[model samples]
Target: MRLSDVWPVRGVELRHGVLELRPMTEPDLPTILDRLPDDLEMDPTLPRYAALDPGVGRAVALVQGYWRAMGGWSPQDWALPFVVRLAGEVVGAQVLEGPHDYGAERVVDSSSWLVQQRRGQGLGTLMRAAVLELAFGHLGAVAAISSAYLENAASLGVSRRLGYADTHTSVLEHNGRQLQHLRLERDAWHGSGRGRAVTVRGVGPALPWFGLDGERA
Candidate 1:
């Protein structure tokens, strides 16, 4: 039997024009690692990303992180590690996180990273839009939230274009950096029509896994 037959989330998919966002699978790990930039730069202060050997060692950590998230998933709290593909080519990763009591709160948060070479191609905006669609449109999320380092204009810009508003700023202890937190309510998202063109599939069987009613799926 297919894995998705047992774990419906594995079958969930989102599409916007040429961009597609789907759950990251074990088989996809090698391709994702291969796409990693050879000269990846990281701040030495962040203990998590700072690896003595940033090549194979760091890649192993990332794959492990994905595995941990997948294995630890529950209705109370979960994360969808979406692999972003542009016209069938892996370009980046987008993650949507539902914290504890997600069913009661109906709030979700997201973060994404695009390949260095794929920067500035509007793919970032599309990737975020696609996931927000799955969150606010398909998953019954009432509000979608995100945060980005102050210096990261590209990420903030994507949030702005997608109708997110500045809510506050908080210090990121990992690097002692400040990031702007943004939020977008369902009404605002619907009015903005950002992800209107996006479509979600395989949500019916996944609804129960998300602590949501199966009827809407």
Candidate 2:
């Protein structure tokens, strides 16, 4: 798919019960913050650096600023972010970055948290897979990358179940303390056991977005 001609955005209601990746509005901010964990951990390996702070509100603003600065969305060149909706409510956020400025490549990161009452329902796995479909099928990313702190078993388990392999481990800082981190790359994603089950849709114009002028590192 070539991202240069057009881009797709709408509520992608999935059959796995209830879900949607819709355009985020100011109203969505309140619910998004409510779902964040009180002790949100900012895994250093991840791009947005801070988490587990009492400042989820400030973080949301940062996300808004980051995407808005990506220039104009001309079908192929833009960075898109989404609010994960379930049962008609926004629960978490997903980021699909591509049509990159630094190099010719595209990738996505699925970061989310459910309210205290909604934990352990296998929702994370489903949500991550859905966004991955959007990246590989809709956004034409050669690979998707997801990282987690070694301490967070729930998040790490979701990645492992989805076929992510450890690319490397590094040290990260949060709360004036160091945590172990793991990076999962694309080749490992394809080799994952569950790669085939997630169905994808509307992937045609995403190529130019991931296509760079030269080879990617």
Candidate 3:
């Protein structure tokens, strides 16, 4: 049987034109490791996958982390580490995570990366939009949150383009770097018309895993 038959999360897929976002399968791991963006000196405060040093160690940690997420999945806390593909070629990764008490809070957070050569093509924005669609349009999220180092213009740009407003700014004590936080409410998401054309498949069976009773949009 296909893994998706037992693990519904593996069946989830988000598509917007040439870009697609889906759970990273075991077979995709090696290719993703090879295509990870060259060191951009990611912020130490970012998610472990994004902050790790590139090479064998980071690759191994990522593989283990992927398994841990799957094994630890629950309604209260879960993460979808999505492998991003642009025109059928691996580009990077995007993750959507729900915190403890997620059912009560109805909020979700997202993080992502794109290889150096893909930076200027706007794929980052498109991929992010696709995930937000899953969060707000399907998963019943009341708000979607994102953060980026103050110096990372590309990420902040993607956030703004998707109607996320500046929520706060804080310093990461670990690195003393300023971090910009942004949020997009469901109404604002629908109003922005971003990801309007994005289509989702295989999410129906995954709703319960996301702690939702049924699809919202």
Candidate 4:
């Protein structure tokens, strides 16, 4: 996949009947504020203060800054976030992050979350798959990665469905406890080759539309 196309970074949307991700708007703020996930608070893996760490702290802060800059969050760089929708209702946000224009060839890392109401319905797997489509299909991302709390079976479960193999584990603190972390790489994803086929159209206006060989469209 080509990885240089600069997306709108404003109001991008990924759609599939019943399952979709749209940009955040003022009206959506209520839903966003109302439905944000508190996984870190409930997970045993997170440290009592993992959220304070520079990496995790920066990650969350950057999301806030980006949201404020756009006056709301949609999909954009470093933290390309989205409002995951199901049957026209807001459910969560899917994020693509890590270094953009990473290294020479370009790579991306994905992260995502859905409100408590949407969990256990298999929506998490679909949402991450949707993020992959954005990264590999339109963004021309040469490769990708994903990470999750190791003990968070549900999150890891989604990775498994999307073909992410276990990389290694690290320990960190979140809300107020220690949590194990797991990493996933693109090579393992390809080797597994098990995620559902996700396709997108009608995104021309949101993207710079790079050509097949990765030159300008």
Most accurate candidate by TM-score: 1
Error of 1 at 32 (Å): 0.5
lDDT of 4 by residue, 1-217 (tens): 4321444444466765468776555466556655655553322322334548544543454345445535432233344557787777778877665354443445677666677877899888777877776766566566666566555788778877766656666555433433334454555554555334565654555454222233311
* lDDT per model vs. reference: 0.83, 0.55, 0.83, 0.58
Candidate 3 lDDT over residue span 1-217, tens digit each = 9756677988889998788888988888889878765564433433465454466556666677677777888888888999998878898898888876788898999878888888898898888889888888888889999998898898999999889999999998887989999999999889878868899888998888887866565
Backbone clash numbers for all candidates listed: 0, 18, 0, 17
Worst 10 residues of 2 by lDDT: 7-16
TM-score of each prediction? 0.90, 0.65, 0.89, 0.67
Model 4 clash count equals 17
User: Model 3: how large is the Cα RMSD against the reference?
Assistant: 3.0
Provide C-alpha RMSD values for all models, in order. Answer: 2.7, 6.0, 3.0, 7.1
Which regions in candidate 4 have their CA more than 4 angstroms from the true location?
1-7, 40-65, 68-77, 98-105, 173-196, 205-217
lDDT for each residue of candidate 2 in 72-146, tens digit (9 for 90 to 100): 554345555567667876666655555444244555555656556666887778777776765654444666656
Task: Kindly give the stretch of ten consecutive residues in candidate 3 with the minimal lDDT sum.
Answer: 38-47
Candidate structures ordered by TM-score, highest first: 1, 3, 4, 2
> What value does the lDDT take at residue 22 in candidate 1?
87
